[model samples]
Target: MDINLVLSELQKQNKSVYKNVFNQFYKGMVLYANNFLFDQQTSEDIVQEVFIWLWENAKNIEINTSLKSYLYAMVRNRCLNYLKSIKITDDLNLIDLNSALLLEEDIDNISEDEKAIIYRQILKIVEGFPASMQQIFKLKFVENYKYNEIADELGISVNTVKTQLKRAKLKIGESIPLLLALFLHH
Candidate 1:
């Protein structure tokens, strides 16, 4: 499916095409939102809200960029706005804002090979997490396993799996800027 067609279809009020786009992009967009908020439910809610708004105003909305870029930018802005609404002065949230900026653009300046190396370094950071935490993190994000699936395989509760994943996101999130700096210095 060509994502480029999404804009034209939505403009034409093509419900089927809209559903297809949602199915194709929803999971990835949710993950992208999670990278900012680190709260699964809220991330899902934010993405849902974005999609709802998209459909409700599809005919009126103007998107000059690719649908992927527009969708991600919307999610990123919402996530950052949520963080600000809570309290922007907090130091941890400041770190999150930095991470959001880096992620929202997906580091477009870097080549695919550079991104792979950065991903490897990020994995090294994940390696520093506790054994089970690292395992659960990899299973969820790398393998795209659901919480229940991860819980079942690890013989742990879903809540436990969620907690570990959250911690993993936070830890890895904190290192994003530093890693970007490292990559830039090279």
Candidate 2:
């Protein structure tokens, strides 16, 4: 169960060796991940995922230095990414809260229930949009696609794609100002 033996076994793609490796490093990896991510469960999940990825990509993975250092580095980066995502979600939630606060004075005009209903309606509308439009919107908004990339994939002129995107945003702006505001405000 030595480190060198584990690495050699892993390089040879031996599945049995992973049990021992996981047992030996699981606690240390979780602790390392928790240093950045703060949540114990998330840290453990990230560590597990990193180990799984290591196993899957073991053939191409060149361990020049100690396996421990490599594993620790992977755990650290994954933890940092998890922390960053949490920060982003927190910021978006804060914007939603601020929007609620701003609309609070007109409570009778726009109740929280009404806001939820409107959001659901907007989601339905997006679902009903043309497949091409839906894909473009998802790539641009959800997957963060660049104009050039989207154009290349869609096999359309850049300006035409940009125009379509602009029209889509304008339509959304008019149909669902709250949702558009939230996206832009973020």
Candidate 3:
């Protein structure tokens, strides 16, 4: 399928072209989203939402990259936003029960762009880890694999998986302050 031609048709609100694009990309998008979200249903929903948005804004949407790249980036940003919302709720629950209501309001007010920046920064840090640690971290977090599953696939012990993940997290934790400082100063 010629993505450019399909995109052209999409901009004209052609259902056949929209269906073709959906058929070609939907499953791949769902799998890509699942890598971040680790939930089949949520991944499908996110991809569906992206397609819906694409259809709604097709006439005004500008694509500087391949359609695949744009779609994947959209999925990644949405997954990060979803994760951040969950994290905020979890943090609020751990901090104070009474403040939960207030935090819920604040959480909804948090900027998605800021979350995407933080997530990208974290990904940069993760990429700088040792190769083995990077693989372990990606398998554990990005791929949402259990320690034992990672160990089995990598032919390593569960303890090794745990130790490597701990090291990776520690490295990320140490670099976060410096990264945030630079980000803020810039």
Candidate 4:
């Protein structure tokens, strides 16, 4: 299939084309994930996550390169992330109940510079979101506004407020794998 046509269909959010593309890529992606993570089930899960991310960002994602290469890259990155997270857990010595219990308190031991870096990345991504969705997200999350409050302020119905917030959350969830890769590495 022509990648441009597939991408166009993706922009339209066509379910059938999306399914076709996912099915075509699934095996290779899983193999790629498995090479690093060495777990078939987790590799399958990671590939599903990659496809979900692709679906969510289809419109914004540039496909100037081959889709196969893109899928390979995503799987490789996710597997590396899985390995790095395992390394972190090992280094923290959280192999026992006692260490697990102390983990919560140790989080506050994060240095100010680390916190600032994470906060800045979060802000950058949020700011990059579409303007209306950004406003809805800020109102819902930062302002802690109820759906009704958001509806009244925007002069939209409560249902509209709810829908917008849901869409905003979906967008964030779709971006999560990528964000996790970046933040976990940092």
Candidate 5:
């Protein structure tokens, strides 16, 4: 099938044409995704997801290259993103392990009422952050969200999420010690 014809059908929202494209390219795209993810099921899922996204966004898609290249690039990008999210989860596990003991020691010593007081003060510090930074901070730390998840939910890029988080951490680090020292001393 001609790429231009397929794209033309796509713009017209032709379901049969979309199905034909899916049938033609699905297997190769899955294999391409599996090259990076090493998981057949996940690769298939990603490929299917790409097809869905392509279908949904057909009207807006502008392909300067061949359709094959565009579809392959989408699969490849999705695979890389999957790997990145996995790495982030692993890194978060390591961070959690490193911090658990310190948190446990300090938390064990504090009364529930005092902990509430500390939480309120910490919330105050967080509230003072820039709007976007404060929302990202709460979504990530308090709500236990991943960086990409926060970015997707907030409609920002991953780099922007990381930058905001870095700045938030610095600000929190500057504020938290005084609050902690006041509590930990008593």
Candidate 6:
């Protein structure tokens, strides 16, 4: 598919083109979001929000990269914001619990610096992956490319892309807790 042509049609508010792009990306976006959020419903909601935002701002939207990349980045940022909001809510609940007990202790919330450290650590871990795996991971998460897109770009099979991504996720997941603990303990 000619992504450029599709994007131009989208900018023109062509309903058929919009529907085609939505159909092409919706499932992939949801899956990409679910990697961060781990909740199917929240992932779906975030992807839907992205699509709605695209439709509403189609005329003014300026995408420098492929539309797939832009959409994936949007969903990724939203998921990160959602996670931060959840953390803040949890901290508030803890504060309320302490207040109910009449205790005057301080509660430490996750700071932005800590979040940055965690993100940097994760990126480092990804960098340590094999070249093929690293490329696949970046395409899937960083650029938000679908399996087919990654496969086509790399001249590999879709199954190869999926396998490499799965392996990368497992490796990253294993290291994340240790990285978080190391940073949070400081």
Q: Per-model C-alpha lDDT, please?
A: 0.74, 0.65, 0.72, 0.68, 0.75, 0.73
lDDT of 1: 0.74
Q: How do the residues 96-186 of candidate 5 rate in per-residue lDDT, one tens digit apiece? A: 2225312334544656666656555555666678778988976787567898999999999999999998887677667666656666678
Off by over 4 Å in 5: 88-186
Model 2 lowest lDDT segment of ten: 89-98
Per-residue CA lDDT of candidate 2, range 14-57, in tens?
Answer: 87887777887899999877655445677889999988997888
Residues 1-186, candidate 1: write the lDDT tens digits: 455477779888899998988998899999998776556777999999999989988877777777888899999999999978755322322222235424544455665666666665565676678889977876776556889999999999999998887787788768776767665556
TM-score of each candidate structure, all chains considered together: 0.49, 0.45, 0.47, 0.47, 0.47, 0.47
Choose 1 or 3, whichever is better by TM-score: 1
Output the number of the TM-score-best candidate.
Answer: 1
Error of 4 at 182 (Å): 41
Q: lDDT tens string, model 6, 1-186?
A: 676787778888999999988998899999999777656778999999999999989878887888899999999999999978755222223222213222222224446666556555655676678888987876776566888999999999999998887787677667766555554466
Which pairs clash in model 2? none
Runs of candidate 6 exceeding 4 Å displacement: 88-186
The alpha-carbon lDDT assigned to residue 168 of candidate 4 equals: 60
Superposing every Cα of model 2 onto the true structure, what RMSD results?
A: 11.7
Cα error, residue 143 of model 5, in Å, equals 22
Q: Better model by TM-score, 2 or 5?
A: 5
Model 2 residue runs over 4 Å out of place are 1-5, 88-186
Candidate 1, which ten residues in sequence have the lowest lDDT sum? 89-98
Give RMSD (Å) of candidate 3 vs. truth. 11.4
